[model samples]
Target: MEYSFRIQLVAIVSLMLVFPNTQGWGEDGHTIVCSIAQARLSNTAAEKVKELLPPGNDLASMCSWADHVKFYLPWSSALHYIDTPDNLCTYQYERDCKDQNGEKGRCVAGAINNYTTQLLNHGTDNSYNLTQALMFLAHFMGDIHQPLHVGFTSDRGGNSINVHWYTRKQNLHHCWDANIIETAEERFYDSNIDEFIDAIQQNITKTWSSQVEGWETCNSNETTCPDIYASEDIKAACQWAYKGVSDGSVLEDDYFLSRLPIVNLRLAQGGVRLAATLNRIFG
Candidate 1:
């Protein structure tokens, strides 16, 4: 509307074109996470979510809304991931939660906290946009679980490291972001995203049943524990994502088969934790 706002929007759109690798998990990954979460939500939280979402849209359908709006909301770009110190394989909110400009609380973990805090105002005298808050909280929960989202600062979380995912050439970040999930969907699920999600859901109920509660619990009555999730992410980044792969490495069957389980686990954790956090918030 305003002339200055229009100029700012154009500038941010330019940045989006220049830095396309800042995204979190791909569309299917996000949808899988949100679908799991929405199914697990308490009645109160689910109804609140329904009220907040746009008409005819569910949480899973809007899970990627945060990613889509980055062009106009430039400040949100940095909030999609954290850049920890190179070779550390550890994440500390104070040290690693800043943006490239070194602004604290600008990373994915902080984004979750900030949005969760905003959503806590639901059913009361609310000021912040709870719809955006819900979408961001749901989205960042998935991002924090993405191992590479809390990856080394030197490589921009593997975005700069070129690699070949099987045959096609792409970056390490893109592999973790979309390629791996897409490949898994195509090869294993007949390219059906819903089938991929159903398989993960089945694992959550049976294979991972005992561990789900532990993943959902937070110490000291916290609504969310992103610090714990971020810590796990960096460790996974070291142990699984960047372990044997070098720049220009070819990620083939061995890499994909081994890493798909970790991806599945992270998606499950992201979904379970998101539902747990929202339940705590809206309960």
Candidate 2:
């Protein structure tokens, strides 16, 4: 790299060293997705999920359970994302997923399909299986919509791209994961996830709501088509998440303001699709 670019990269990495909260979406973002899904869930689906979770755990609260258990299930860490090749901004399950050490049917798309099958079988399996399936579905649905989660493999889905968030220093992946949603909530709803979900609930445009069927229609055997949802995130990551961003990028109000609609739409779609999947399983 050129000397100037190298210097910029070092400066950005230094910023990341100081900033905190670099995990996926933090708890707040997951809560928004799960809360929306919980509100829209059918009574039957709601009852079904409730019975599977431990006492005092609902979809919203248990949304983070997958992240917790992932520590124990080392093989499951790959279940959270599908890393597309660099700059292409698209996904072919065979092209992207197989490269992660040849684990077939085990990435986010595969996990969704696997868990969906398990949930549909319902009581045919142990409660442990059922609960694990539910948690993965709840979490991965949100993960799929997080654009960075489907980003370039070269950058580990943007995790390696150091940039400053208005001089605070964070990675591009972290910016999408935790910053954008948090900033959007505070700006639009005063940090009220409930209110944000409610507004989305009321205004779920016909186009996006219709997408639930479109996404589910993807055929598993048809090359990349089966994982269109993952592809969607990859496209978003290319167009918006990494479009203007580079090493030493300094993000601020203009960037956040422009991205709010994108964030909200993804959250809304994630919630609705999650409900649709669960309803299919339980209802």
lDDT agreement with native, every candidate: 0.88, 0.75
TM-score of each: 0.92, 0.84
Q: Could you tally the backbone clashes for each prediction? A: 0, 0
Worst 10 residues of 2 by lDDT: 217-226
Name the runs in model 2 displaced over 4 angstroms.
1-22, 205-226
Best TM-score among the predictions, by candidate number: 1
State the lDDT of candidate 1 residue by residue for 1-283, as single tens digits.
3345446444543554455434679888899899999999999989888977766778898787778778667889999999988997888999888888889999999999999999887667456777778888999999999999999988998999999998899999889989889999999989999999889999999999999999999999889999999999999999999989999999999999999999999999999999999999988
Give one digit per residue, the lDDT tens place, for model 2 in 156-205: 98888888887688888888888887777787789888887777776675
Per-residue error (Å), model 2, residue 82: 1.0
TM-score of 2: 0.84
- Please give the lDDT score at residue 189 for candidate 2: 87
